[model samples]
Target: MENRDTETYPLLTPLNHRQQNQTTTVVFNAESNDISPITGAGEFAREFLVESKKLWYLAGPAMFTSIAQYSLGAVTQVFAGHVGTLQLAAVTVENSVIAGFCLGITVGMGSALETLCGQAFGAGKLDMLGIYMQRSWLILNATALILSLLYIFADPLMKLIGQTKAISEAAGVFALWMIPQLFAYAMNYPIQKFLQSQSKIMAMAWIAGVALVGHTVFSWLLMLHLGWGLAGAAVVLNCSWWFIVVAQVVYVLSGSCGEAWTGFSFKAFQDLWGFVRLSLASAVMMCLEVWYFMALILFAGYLENAEVSVDALSICTNILGWTIMVSFGINAAVSVRVSNELGASHPRAAKFSLVVAVITSFAIGILLSLVLIIFRHQYPMLFSNDPEVRKVVIELTPMLALCIVINNIQPVLSGVAIGAGWQAAVAYVNVACYYLFGIPLGLFFGYALDFGVLGIWSGMLAGTVLQTLVLFIMVYRTDWNNEASLADERIKKWGGA
Candidate 1:
């Protein structure tokens, strides 16, 4: 049956043949066209090898960059944890809740560049990449200014959400110190996506590595040695992020990105409304996903032993976040592959890339799940010393493992949606699955039934499972040729091609 489908569709073809001008001409000249052909087990295996190499070529540096970048915060959290329980809760709350909110918005808005720049690059309209990035910077900076208000008023907001006075006050102070990091997010995400779209990720990885190392050194010196506590953690973290942003900007300006980094353009100022619309849709899609887990932190804060519950949940979420960086790397790679293929008018290649990415990410997810389960008892010691917090984390290990598995696949699918310019559609799915269905069910389980954190997580995991299934079906049934046409239309509409 698989062989029959392969022969009938003939989507998996040699990379060399697909790159030929003849194939490109045929694809764009025809209203409907089939991709290059492949036959036999040997040919199929060969194509698969070629596709995997291309996927990992991008994924490798992307993953390392993501992990190193994410570690900036994770390392800060570790430093905060050793300070004291109240300090741990405050840093976690500020990082996961306050900065997290801005991250979702800024990063999500920046993802609009992934779609635009990837397609534009594949379409060979490299000039548009820089323009699109500038547009994102403008939108995100404006967004950063507005979101700074959240930091300014974080204390009242946390209290309004039923947090204790102590945690609220500490977290609010931490939020103020983090205001610099928020603007850094605005600049960093767009630059990262811009570089990724052009496969210039190794530079990002190097920069992030440097930043992480510097962060660790400064955090140790200021937070621990000098005894500045949370203030020191905040200072180092903010500086580390800005270091990354500055390094990336310097690289782009150095002409290392070639055509993709054309000097600042007045053209970016044009078509402001259209860019904002797409950016808003992208923001909604990502914010829904990011803020979903964030809600767990919020809910955990309301439990009977609120500090312990919040501490354990934050630790669990932190661990989950580290694994998420791996998946997000795969996500970025697949998005680039799919969008590049579609923009190049190779629908079958786009579809084939999706198949390979899913298999690869799912396998990695399984491996990571096993590792987590094996180390479940020992890993919490890295984040907290409290006996109660460690005990609660052990109790939640099973659910955390399950979340790790599901999250691996979900982000890859969301990447597909972004690559195909389906942000609005996926945003609706997130709302239905995460908010309409998941949150309500979690409320019933956590509060009404008294299952506490475990019940709330289980309910939320159910929603994630449902969302993943829906996304899988969506991708499986996608008309790739139609999507390719849509990609062409998008590029033309944006004046890229």
Candidate 2:
């Protein structure tokens, strides 16, 4: 009745084909080496799990390293704050404003190595990582020399920017004392990018962790016990940073990053201009994003009730900056993941990696936002005892929470662009949306419309919206296969595998 002719023919099932011609039934077992056919949904779920595991492996260590190093500066400020309000003002301006600016430039310049070393490693040209890092040193050190002038003249710049004379002079002295740290920053960033490309992130994490512990103890000793004030705090913080750098250098030379770090060569001096162009794009894109937030602080200072507004906004910025570092770590992870897959000629894998990274980071962002909202009133006690500042902070918490979510998503997308070698394009988008449109809108809302700090913040958020939209479109329209082909050609052009 059930098609006896076909039954007699015994539809030759592929699974049972090796069996005798007689009718046979095959059953799949979980313990068996053979895999049964999977449904479409099942395949997707499986791949998603695999990709999530891979992403977290890279992101976890990166986040730890980033937060630990970030704390070095934060800890110095804490020590200085306990010294006196004047000392706190000096340390904050020097560390948070001027140094933060130089940091953006240095770190952004080093990230070009992320693209290069990442692809080179993925293409099995391990030795190039060392050359790439050495090249970064040559470029970054030269850049650091130019940046040293910024540290040397911090007082006049602060004064010109309308900072109080007393605070500006003190901060300037503090800035020059911290100048040695600039070279440390220059050396550290490239090495971090190089090792990260090779999946050696744990070394960076552990080194930073150790340096942070040392930083805390020394901060207490130097700033409090020794009563050395701002100068002592700056010196200790600089030493703490260099400690991390020295440890990283040891890790590379100890053969932990073998092959990827063949001894440094003069060849790093070759084709320098091409590296500079890309490095400049990376720097511009990053600085646009970094300076955009600094503008928020600058605008907040002029709003009505300037005292409360600035204090509340500064507290919010500190928390936001700390949280954004998590997203930054995830950004680094995704950049490495996408670039590596492209370099390895696996376009689909690159696409999958990007998807996994965004989903994972977005989920974390949501959790962070929820926590910030829930604890808005309570957490202000960590940084402020002033009742008025706390109230204002609570008022602004919701907007800040939402922006936290956006911060997480946008950086990961930027990382995608970086992996795809789209820095120059993203730089243009950032400048247009952030400087040309966002800052002006914020100024209009805050000053002309008299909307105060919230108005200014809303404008900054609008800029983020435009920048994120452009990134989405760029990433959406990308032909991954073509990008993979381009990565292959790039490696060959660089004399890699």
Could you tell me every candidate's TM-score relative to the true structure? 0.94, 0.89
Please give the distance, in angstroms, between residue 233's alpha carbon in candidate 2 and its true position after superposition. 2.2
- What TM-score does candidate 1 reach? 0.94
lDDT of 1 by residue, 158-272 (tens): 9999999999999999999999999999999999999888888789999999999999999989998999999899889999999999999999999987777779888889888
- Compared with the true structure, all predictions reach lDDT values of 0.86, 0.78
Q: How many residue pairs clash (N, CA or C atoms closer than 3 angstroms) in each of the candidate models, in the order given?
A: 0, 0
Report the Cα RMSD per candidate: 3.9, 9.5
Least well predicted 10-residue stretch by lDDT in candidate 2: 7-16
lDDT of 2 by residue, 116-194 (tens): 8777665556667788888889999999999999999999988887776777898899999999999999999999998
Q: Judge candidate 2 against the unseen true structure and give its global Cα lDDT, from 0 to 1.
A: 0.78
lDDT of 1: 0.86
Residue ranges of candidate 1 with Cα displaced over 4 Å: 1-42, 494-497
Best by TM-score: 1
